[model samples]
Target: MSVTDTEATGRAPGGGAGPEPAVLTRRLRLVLVLLLTTQFMLAVDFAILNVALPVIGRGLGFPLAHLQWIGTSFALCAAGFTLLFGRVADLFGRRRLFLGGLVVLGVSSLVGGLAQSPGMLIVARVCQGLATAAVTPAALSLMTTSFPEGPLRRKALGLNGALMSSGFTTGAVLGGVLTDLLSWRWAFFINVPVALAVLVIAPRVIEESRPEKRPELDVPGAVSVTLGLLAVVFGLTQAGEQGWSSPGALLSLVAGVVLLVVFYFVERKVAAPLVPLGVLGKRSVAWGNVAGLFAFATFTSLVFPLTLYLQDVLGFSALVAGLSLGFLGLGTVTGGVTASRVIGRFGTRTTLLLGGSLQAVFTAALVCLGADRSWMWLMLFAGFAGGIGNMLAIVGFMVTATSGLADHEQGLATGLATMTQQVGITLGTPVMSAAATTAMTGSGAVAVLGGLKGAIGVNAALVLLGVLSSALFLRDDRPAALRASRRSGHGRSARRKGGGRFRPVA
Candidate 1:
């Protein structure tokens, strides 16, 4: 009875009157399938470039110094616009933006594949990131809006989180195969067919929805936050390449901090802010983001250094190194399939603790890795452990962070969720690199091996800090009301029927 405008109108059956519950449920499942497929393409887009970079540089004839732009350009644009576009989806229309983004992504992919020069390729990649920024939050908002808060949403999110994780590792292997077998251009061009399929199917499957009372755009908040995020991402990327103490990195970092502080004040004054300061004040959202930040940072930090160790220290080829990480993809898929069940039985917080604990253990285990140690253990089992841990942790973070918000603010919630991930990844590698470099032991292979151990140790510590924060600050994953319902049911069958409920916010 107290359902909001969106629940009442936007969620109305289909075009006719209203479909039966059975029919509606089926429709929702199809929608979920479409959304997850799109997510896979987006997530893989990032990783697919990794193994193809050298070929891309040669094809485009760019100087070695500028080759990084193929990837960095995408990161810069994605981190810059993700939040701003989140608000735009809420204000304009999520379905429209989501579709537009797919088109943009498709177009950019085509352009990139066909590009003849470095500048053209970089421009196309930047467009791909910009489109991804729009697509990510809009897609998440659509999923949250489509399902009620219960087993349904939990399962949906868990599966999505898994696919995203698996997509990354899978893309690494995919890129290598595509590059060696066909051409590097296929890495960019592959998105075209998938995007086209989603583009064709999405309109029929997904229903359009947006906030109830449209508000004016918060220009001040938007500009400040976007620039702040952009500066921060650029600074972190610079630090990864040029060291944190460099003048450019330091200046960008300083500017980003100043802009963000200004944005905070501006958001308070704005009639309709880009990000409500109040939403961020909530315990679950705030600490969930903190957890999400470390979850992403720690997992991503392992890839580059480990790649070096495999290829340089242990004498693996590029293709072998890339394929070895396939264990991570398997773990991610397995974790996704099981995370919702784990949450259903144990609870979100417990699952989160378990996940964080797993990640910490995985990274610490890597510290024992040596040149003589069988690559099979580290590359296969350890990679799988790390993959599952990161995926589970990510799903937990997303569920907790966005749980209590009103439907209208789901965009902002998803935006912040995406933003934390991007920022975490931006900061993760550089900080870990610094920690490892400070303790460098010897030269070439030996030095690289020793440095990686230190770096992985730092990663373990960061994840442990995340575990501490989750245990200390996050509100219980299940509300008192939901627990009461489950208690009343009191059986294996009833427990499966136990639906999630909410308590009043403090």
Candidate 2:
């Protein structure tokens, strides 16, 4: 039998063992459940603390200037460490790193729950970010490896995307309820039990896979990229607070750009680069990542300003604000579930264009809201539309980005995509914040409303840019070899199923 035939038969070359029995299917389901649970927990942490921020600031006596750091700290650490951990996953086992990350996440949550000062909380949040850095890429790699590329993979990816989008919106609502009924501390504490459960179950349920050959960690490349991203994110954030022309902010921004340029060159020369240049060479992958980054950035900006607007301008309680954001989650779920169908009918290009255009329209509408506007339903609709856009754009982008990669490179591909998202959020948040603040120079509610409008307008424009990039740069053609390989693999499997006769099953 040919190599393809062996693979098709789902047996060893010597036919030593056949496929597992029905009991293994049950085990596979359990594995999927555990993985999804961990993913949900990670996603929730990304947004859960947003709803609790005001309360945390009030409780800890954090100044307005420093309040943003509560979120930034986590985001920055996660962004900084993602690439490094991706490399680590390539060296060590992804499962080992994933389980270890869960432990760190649980422990950090416990510490964060007990934090008495903003400093300690920031440290704990950073730790949680580090844990996430490890968990997310590994989880994605695991998913790709466990499920073969086809309808099964598409379904899994769609569900994963839904979990991710829903987690953010759900976090806001849950954070509010937890903060109001219990304490803001519970927001952090809640992760303890969830993380514990994931840690215990993941090892047994999730299959362990290692890189084909252990790859050397590109320490210098990692450091340079980390510093570059950190510098840029810090500068943007400072510009929001210290003025865009400030010497400190300008210098940081310039330095970040230079460092990133250097890092790019370094990747080209390194034997085992942090991110393979070949991956970026693929136009679909490159454009897809860029679209994902911009879309996510718009989202990052929307969350902070919207939360503030509800509380400060509309006088909504945290819980009410959180509940309002649930519309976004519902929309996200709707989009995620429906995207595969949309893609099947319309292809990725049209789906992205439509999603992006709708998102831009709704995001712009958010700017028109006011204290007297009793259009709560309008707010919900806008959020839902934006969620739909996000789901279509994100899932399409991811599918395109890693479309033709080898199984071993899956971790690296997932890492680069995730890193882009973090960078987008890091950059987008501060820029939008600054825009809003600048728009609200006066003290009245009208001034606040104006500033928020400006911010939302900026986000809308960014979404439009993402749409243009996707439409212009993303290619529609699948590599002919990849398509052939898939067809051959499927044919061989069918033949094997018929006991060496080319009889079709089902």
lDDT of 2: 0.78
Which residue pairs of candidate 1 clash? none
> Which tens-of-lDDT digit does each residue in 392-449 have in candidate 2?
8777776766667766677887888778777776777678878887788788777787
lDDT of 1 by residue, 264-373 (tens): 99989987888888999998889999999999888877787788778888888988888777777788788888888887776778778889899888878888888864
Model 2 reaches what TM-score against the true structure?
0.85
Best by TM-score: 1
Q: TM-scores, in order shown?
A: 0.91, 0.85
- Those runs of model 1 whose alpha carbons end farther than 4 Å from true positions after fitting are 1-24, 373-375, 479-506
Model 1 — which ten-residue stretch has the worst lDDT? 15-24
